[model samples]
Target chain A: MNSITSNVFGPAKSINVARVLLCLEEVGAEYELVHMDLFQAKEQKSPEHLARNPFGLVPALQDGDLVLFEARAIAKYVLRKYKTEQADLLREGDPEEAAMVDVWTEVEAHQYHQALRLIMLECFLNPTLRGLPTNQAVVDEAVEKTKKVLEIYEARLSEHRYLAGDFFSFADLNHFASTFYIVDATPYGSLLDSYPRVKAWWEDLMSRPSFKKISANMTTK
Target chain B: MNSITSNVFGPAKSINVARVLLCLEEVGAEYELVHMDLFQAKEQKSPEHLARNPFGLVPALQDGDLVLFEARAIAKYVLRKYKTEQADLLREGDPEEAAMVDVWTEVEAHQYHQALRLIMLECFLNPTLRGLPTNQAVVDEAVEKTKKVLEIYEARLSEHRYLAGDFFSFADLNHFASTFYIVDATPYGSLLDSYPRVKAWWEDLMSRPSFKKISANMTTK
Candidate 1:
């Protein structure tokens, strides 16, 4: 058995780390999650960890010599590696559906992440860190911009059950991790409330057994 | 043989459209390119095109019932469908290499695009249409931001030939498309000259027969 070692410096409360843990649950994979203390600047910036990830980010995965960073990439790798029976998780039998899923994943990585990062930086990181100030103008612009992007999702979910059509794929899970984090922190939480279809979709996704397991794991730390 | 249709708008000089064309060449795939007259504002915002892409973006691909937008997604599809011998365009063999490629592509789509778009809007799009005068400060800031990013690439390429190591993958291609376009318009054109390894790598890529073919096609239109 090729064992995988996941080194995560983030708290279980971190949405980025939760994205990976949720992916493991979806794939039913058993792996070690080595928790690193971000407060102490322990494992993440350590020379060993930096060797694995030059960026010194958390949620780095190691399978023998195959060490990878990036939460989305690691999530996709887990899905591809473990979920042979779960067609909806990674590869789709229908090319079109698969492409749609890819599109949503890209959206999650690009537009969704862009908005979410700005909000997170303002609400959490910026105040405590060495970056730009959590200015109201920047936050407002981010919220407005994010709402515009989410409107597209709102329209899509109005017609379909999931972000990638009917299938509750990892794509939906990925978006949920980031979106729910922003909603949890920002006043723009009501944005989803206005989009009933998206709200329902969120509720449905969070209710999934895999989501439950991952969410439980997140709170435990 | 399945027929594919790609909607390419803006001027023939558009960098985004060139990305798609380059992908087609890499995959050795044949497709019909439908040029949308951006001046007339005719084809891009047309109802049919809008149906394929809600964002009303150019370089949307259509294959039978499958309609795909987002240039990266379309390029990935073309590579998967037509490229017989997978050359690790996105680093196929090793998990780490693949993940690195994926991360760089994300960086390109997210961070690099953000900076480059600012430059483009100020330098090319706004100026060409006689809109607001170009913001020199914004342009300068963007160039600095983009150069910092290139420094990361330079550091990586100094140690390894391509973005994802020795292999010339789609990650390199993605960066090439974005950087080449920005360099064409910026005083930062000479910035690339500072990174000898990256310059050599890029020169080799630009000299590829496939790249040559695509560039020729791009100019003739």
Candidate 2:
């Protein structure tokens, strides 16, 4: 705890890294960000990186002796360990509220990210990383699917101030970083404009200090 | 609370539904299982069903006034509300242990399920659901990927009894149901036999009363 040895290993442009950084900001924790060149170096698949995460993915966290991978897990760790006086990100104490938070968080991971990732890869990474032309068919399909997922978000946001309920929790932050990247980094980002409530919710969450601080340090591409 | 209105809506053979049902059994909760024929009825996408789950997926839980979807979310809800006197399915009070649990649970959803599902669809569900032949190439690729994942599991289980430590938690149960299907219903089922530690851990978890009871009631096909 003295030295804040916990570090996040990944590129700043990574939505997953951005996800963890938002949680760290929410918990007001001091930690180091170790940048790995995911494209040029292919460092994530290196033996050194695989030791931290067997899946060879990034945003792995090293906290003391506990090494953890998976951005959601890392976020849960920060929210649990470095809990701030401001608000509980995971709603740890209230089981019911926490359960709701857990539902939306998983939904973000399973449902929302599923579609957004397709859009990102087809629209953003295809052009940025591989220098390939955007496949219109892929983008069109992804936009259609992502819009369906966001329609649910639009309905849920209409009912609750945030995804889980009236409060801002990790559920909202979970979607924030990914949505930021999908919208800003990808050409299909404009698809979000169709879902009025979802777009408004995105704007509201992005304006928060947690996202604002992280955004200052992140690169879209 | 009066009538135990928690109902899980999905086909009995579904891995996601099986995951939630296992948690319900661990909690010793009485719940209704509403079987929906995905091929014939297709009720999961019906207007009534979409009201509960926007993603139009099965394993949606309607508990009292709170309607929830996403199998992991429903599992969290069951663990929180219907908690039994036996042992906490989730390490509720211990933040560190719970964080570890969260990590593995997400791994089950993200890393393990990603590959396992591919194997299931290609090797198992194709023949059963669609009367299609197993795609050997896809199955081979998935088997290779899943073995890599299980290698990490084998290493971890060698050190600890379960994924998130010794105690039986949702982290273990989350894996139990999916793995039960993959091993029993797929060509790559024997692949698990190669990883001794993971196999032993899987067998140990399967032998638990919670799993034994759920397995008796589940329909694999």
lDDT (10s digit) by residue, model 1, range B1-221: 36655444334456677777778777667777777776566577888888887767777887767788777777777666665554337544455676777767665665667777778678766776567788999988988877766676678788887776777777778765556655565455676787777678778888887776766644311
Q: After superposition, how far is residue A163 of candidate 1 from its true place, in Å?
A: 2.1
Candidate 1 ranges beyond 4 A from true positions: A36-46, A92-94, A115-147, A216-221, B1-12, B38-43, B86-97, B110-126, B129-144, B216-221
* Residue-wise C-alpha lDDT for candidate 2, range B1-221, written one tens digit per residue: 33656889997777888888888888788899999988987889999998888788988988778788888888887887776657587886777788889889888887898888888887778888899998888888888888889989988898888889988888988887668888777656788888999888888888888788777766455
Worst 10 residues of 2 chain B by lDDT: B212-221
Reference-based lDDT, residue A157, model 1: 89
- Interface RMSD of candidate 1, in Å, is 2.1
lDDT of 2 at A60: 96
DockQ of 2: 0.72
TM-score of chain A in every predicted structure: 0.86, 0.93
Off by over 4 Å in 2: A1-5, B1-5, B219-221
Shift in Å, residue B168, candidate 2: 1.3
